[model samples]
Target: MNHRPAEARQSPARTTEVGVRYAIVPVPVLSLETVARRTGLHPDLIRRFVALGLVDAGRDTSGRPVFAPTAPAALARVQRLRTGLCLNYASIGLVLDLLDRISLLEAALRRAGMRSDLPPWT
Candidate 1:
């Protein structure tokens, strides 16, 4: 019982004047206080994450740090590593070092014309 129409079997896309745009990325913009509220961390510690260049936060017109939606997940990971593993800030440095290696691997792959659908942390 194959009753699907030909158009229905076609690739799903919004028919706009600019053709097809397949990527649907979620960009959540959050303030520092909002990130602290979401991650249950102190504002100062969130600032430290920004200072360490761990989270991808950017500025609004007012020039305040606005975190992405992924920031909460990243902060949760860092918090878990710090609390559960009893990792000091210095050990956090080591964790970031390993992550940087992974980043280098991904960059090399990209430079070699390979692709990765996963994030660096994943």
Candidate 2:
């Protein structure tokens, strides 16, 4: 008699139209405390960053803020901008916005086959 469950009987590999097989993997979510530990920042400071929109977070079932694995890196970037450029939190928001816009423009330029290094008049 077969005792294995139905899921165990099937192959784990998933195939796409191109015949490439892929395995599904779940992304790890971090809690606020974990993010704080990873970034070496106080939990209050991390909460302030979340309040200031410097980092993105989602609410868990208990109403606590949860973060993606990238939260630590984002917090580090904010810290770099703060200490390296001497920018305040409010100014950091503006700087981050401008940087994102620049990135998008650069990506568009690349997609259009234009060299970003060259001057526009060239």
Candidate 3:
């Protein structure tokens, strides 16, 4: 019943002369409709989030609201937090703002040669 090859049983990665190279793919800014499609949220929900300052959307050349390529994942996270934690939109917005602030502070600290030895919550 067990007929799997030895290679298949091991890790997927293998040594190669070419080596692995990671390329940073640019995510294009997308319209609200496109964002909604990507995030599986309604356009009206996105608009509400914009109004709440949850998402800072940029404008396209034609003055249409355009979201960053990462917006879908971010919006999905918000949705998860809302449903999983039963949090209101306002609370979610506050949490996101605080998270952003924390990230900025962490980056600044790292840049200043101050590494965090404390636990993550600290």
Candidate 4:
């Protein structure tokens, strides 16, 4: 008797091509306090990141900043990059931007049936 919860039993990215129904749980919208608690970063730091354009935030009806569910992971990545590489916030922001661009380009290339390989850094 498999007694897994409905959510636990279903894969988030299941596709009909594999005879499974596709299901994507909606991304959460979080408040600043919730974001701080979830990410273990101070609200001030999160604000700073926003000011630095490191993380993007949307506004609530009250004109307060709100974050997406993915913000915590993005914050963690910023912290890791800062501590691991000793990079300043500006540099970190640039790196993240480049990484996002690379991802978009790779996806575009894949759709166009072109190989998108990284150039060797020598």
The backbone clash count of each candidate, in order, is 0, 0, 0, 0
Give the per-residue lDDT digits (tens) of candidate 2, residues 8-113: 3234768899998664764457998899999999999998888887777777779998887767887898999999999999888778777877998999999999
Q: After superposition on all CA atoms, what RMSD does each candidate show versus the true structure?
A: 14.1, 12.4, 15.2, 11.5
By lDDT rank, best first, the candidates go: 2, 4, 3, 1
Q: How does each model score on TM-score?
A: 0.56, 0.77, 0.66, 0.70
* Model 4: residue 18 alpha-carbon error in angstroms: 44
Judged by lDDT, which candidate is best?
A: 2
In candidate 1, stretches whose alpha carbon ends up further than 4 angstroms from where it belongs are: 1-26, 97-122
Tens-digit per-residue lDDT, 16-39, candidate 1: 678754423444477899999988
lDDT of each: 0.69, 0.79, 0.72, 0.77
- RMSD of model 3, in Å? 15.2
Best by TM-score: 2
Which pairs of residues have clashing backbones in candidate 3? none
The local distance difference test score of model 1 is 0.69
Cα-based lDDT at residue 36, candidate 4 = 98
lDDT of candidate 3 vs native?
0.72
**Model 3, position 3: C-alpha lDDT score:** 17
TM-score, candidate 1, is 0.56
